[model samples]
Target: MTTRTIALVFHRLRPNAIALARDVAAWAQQSGCKVVCDESDVDAIAQGGHSHLTASSSFRDADLLVSVGGDGTMLRAVHSLNGTLVPVMGVNVGLLGYLTNVEPEMALGALDQWLRGTEGTSFHYDDRMMLRVSIQNGSTKQSWLALNEVVLEKQQSGHTVRLGVDIDGTHFVTYSADGLIIATPTGSTAYALSARGPVLSPRLNALLMTPVSPHMMFDRSLVLDPREEVIVEVMGQRPVEIAIDGVAVHTLLAGDRVSVLAATERARLLRFNDNRFHQILRSKFGLADR
Candidate 1:
């Protein structure tokens, strides 16, 4: 296996993550590997006399990025690595590290194994879909890439979000709900799960649409082939909020239409060869072993 330059990416200065970052950095240096850290991490580790870089510079030349945080931090790191095919490995720090596998204490061991090209060689790599969100009349949306779901929510007080769901210009549902969620199978475990949508296996090739607090009784979740194009129009209140992966992209007016679908580009995440999706599910949801 070829040895690649690895960057140790951590969350913004949190006490818990600091220790893990220190350990990972120390190990990287001792192993004669290059360690890349953010501005704050660089400051913290400067006391230990270890050299590091800002998040901006970390990904510029590194082959791989090791993320130290929960799923949120991992997503942040992935977003920062936009357009680059750098593989990311998440180390679970905070709660709900669904995207992350290795814990703090186990991070060093995992890294050692990865460096030796034995830990994650057998792990399956999954390509995730990204959504491109465009507001009818605004600058490019800031949060166009979502690892989980794209949400169209109501922003005005006491008003509902009336949207017409269309697939390839064909009408699907006209919903009066607090918001609507368009998610992918990889995002099935995220907000889509909380909205009572089906948990699609990560390997499935489909998209999920779930209504959030819909006033109409006929509104139900719809599963469509990955090729279908989803369009949502803001129809009710004067202003509606559009959130992509938990970040607000823009507020739309009554006439604005938001279009979402699978992007040609894909986000690549590194996995431990020994990891299994079913095992993660059983452990996370407390399902009994069969």
Candidate 2:
């Protein structure tokens, strides 16, 4: 029998999350499986003399990567994977765990089932689409991946930044607004939803563009084909801040441009059951069946 490897990725600040990771590590060791953690989180998970856990800079070889926090932690795990095909299991320790598959109490059971294979257990992979974003400033260029939306907003408060939009190399419109959000179907329920953007099925292959507090009357979101590429150019004098998956990463000056499109790689989430999207949405929002 071949040895299996399980990687634990958790929110370092949460003591409960850390404790749960340690428990999972101990369980994996007892089950004759290798337990590892990201190098950045090794110290935290190795605390209290839990020295058996291995520290790995890469999780490409891990059979499974378990996220022991909320949706944000899951997003962090996906970003850390960097397009690796490793399957991620999410155990919710925070509120609103839309991305998580199970609760903390069921984590070990779920892991056991996953280890046992699908012969007698109900386990599957839920692949979700991701987005790739590129920024160009003169000769310097940078790129990042986002499981959620990529935001380009005004850098300074009380000022609206002007951004020019283009689709497939054709100029679209120029907007004076607080920001613009380019989101994948998986991100429809996130910040885009808060901005009044339409909710799309996570299984759909599409992109959503929503404007934030636009000065113009055309403020509705535009859902575009996944194959289409969107370009947002910085217009006027004010600089704009760029955020990937809600984390601020770069600042673009006037004349800089950002390109967004569906990534070729998808995030593989481990799931035990086939839960419908509308059902999950209704449960998440406490929507009553009238």
Candidate 3:
């Protein structure tokens, strides 16, 4: 099957990355491929002087999606995809390119590998785990998918929030902390790591739950089985906010509950042969094998 269509999703605020997105589009068109540019990015693509971009581009219809920015941009791209089967290729234009497949200078080469189906030899699909967060306040309910983590933070400033937790319906400890983070294996390296959570290999299918500055002695991070579900209920007088992948999605009232679990869906990331998780991890943290 030929990959005749490619979608380019970029972070609009990054000028240099926007320029690279346009160049990528132009290059795709030159290779007898159709370029799918998100309407929101149309203006950014225009900045790179592309006048022949294909019209009516949809993330659902593209054979592949390229994210041009940092990990955040890749997360945004993942969000836009809405858990579609469309594999995303992340091109790094910012620092600590954990999710991005290639550096800015290597963008074209990465594209070539994708176009040529250079799996194992140069490119492959690295399926990353995803998270689902559902917040219910009385009769109102909403859900959000996260490539990284779901955070519940205290909004009752000057005072710590009370969070009652349960794992698989068993009563866990009530955490008195500023916030809580429930991250997927893919997110283990992110906020969870900073909060002293253990680093799980990306290939492992697990979930990491870490409390943010809890006031109790039971402040250790919890690594749960993939099938286990986490339920956190707000017990404070004020409110707590639910942050999905760093973006505030909902406000949790005193009685509101947040249910987090491994989503039935997974995120597919483009990876080249030389880009294994351990190598990237070492490089990102400036570790020395010597």
Question: What's the TM-score of each model vs. the native?
Answer: 0.89, 0.97, 0.95
Model 3 is weakest, by summed lDDT over 10 consecutive residues, at 49-58
Q: How close is candidate 1 to the true structure, as a TM-score?
A: 0.89
**What is candidate 1's lDDT per residue for 71-115, written digit by digit as tens?**
888887777776477778889888867788777887887777767
Cα TM-score of candidate 3: 0.95
Task: Compose the digit string of candidate 3's lDDT tens values, residues 1-290.
Answer: 46478888887888888888888988897887888777766767876678777655458888888899999999988888888878899888888877886888988888887787656776778887888888776687788899889999987677789999999999989999989999998888888889999988889888899999999999999988989999999987778988888898788888888899999888988777665678778889999867
Clashes of each: 2, 0, 0
lDDT of each: 0.76, 0.90, 0.85
Model 3 residue 115 CA deviation (Å) reads 0.8
What lDDT does candidate 1 reach at residue 6? 72
Put down candidate 2 lDDT per residue, 32-105, tens digits, no spaces: 89988878888887775678888888888999999999999999889888999899999999998888969899
In model 2, how large is the Cα lDDT of residue 238?
Answer: 96
* Residue-level lDDT for 224 in candidate 1: 87
Clashing pairs in 3: none
